[model samples]
Target: MGVWIRPEVFPIFGAVGAVVGICSMQLIRNITTNPEVRVTKQNRAAGVLENFDEGEKYAQHTLRKFVRGRRPEVFPNMNKYFAEKQ
Candidate 1:
């Protein structure tokens, strides 16, 4: 009885492991490639706003767009935000 059940359980475990591995790889790839997940000095300096409050607003707006799946162009927007400041 035990031997019969062992074979069935092993395959199920293998299938679960494969699914988890694939999902983990995709998550890592997204984190590495997505700009919204990581901020850089260049992005911060690109904003034209001289004040912290204005900068915070711009960042929050960008992040909101990302969260909503709008995929707004972050770098160009940052550049434009700062360019407009001038």
Candidate 2:
């Protein structure tokens, strides 16, 4: 014996499927295209560093990353050390 859905219910199912498909497509597009939805640590750091000059910003970033808590005293001499490197 075969189970059967009503003829009217078939069209309703199609309509609901279409709606679900469209909504899923829209959700995928929003996820892929939305800039605010995806932000990485590196991207955020780059954004923050954009305000400074490239060379100096990298030097400062390196110093901050390696020497922040381990040796806070070295922070004050960063400019002096970078100056010697050049």
Best by TM-score: 2
Overall lDDT per candidate, in order of appearance: 0.68, 0.63
TM values, all candidates: 0.38, 0.42
- Runs of candidate 2 with Cα error greater than 4 angstroms are 1-4, 39-86
Off by over 4 Å in 1: 1-5, 39-86
Q: Write the per-residue lDDT of candidate 2 for residues 1-86, one digit (tens) a residue.
A: 13576666878999999999999986885566444444566665654333336445434555477766674454658867887999
lDDT score, residue 58, model 1? 44
* Candidate topping lDDT: 1
Model 2: weakest 10-residue lDDT segment is 47-56
**Model 1: per-residue Cα lDDT at residue 43:** 68
Error of 1 at 58 (Å): 23
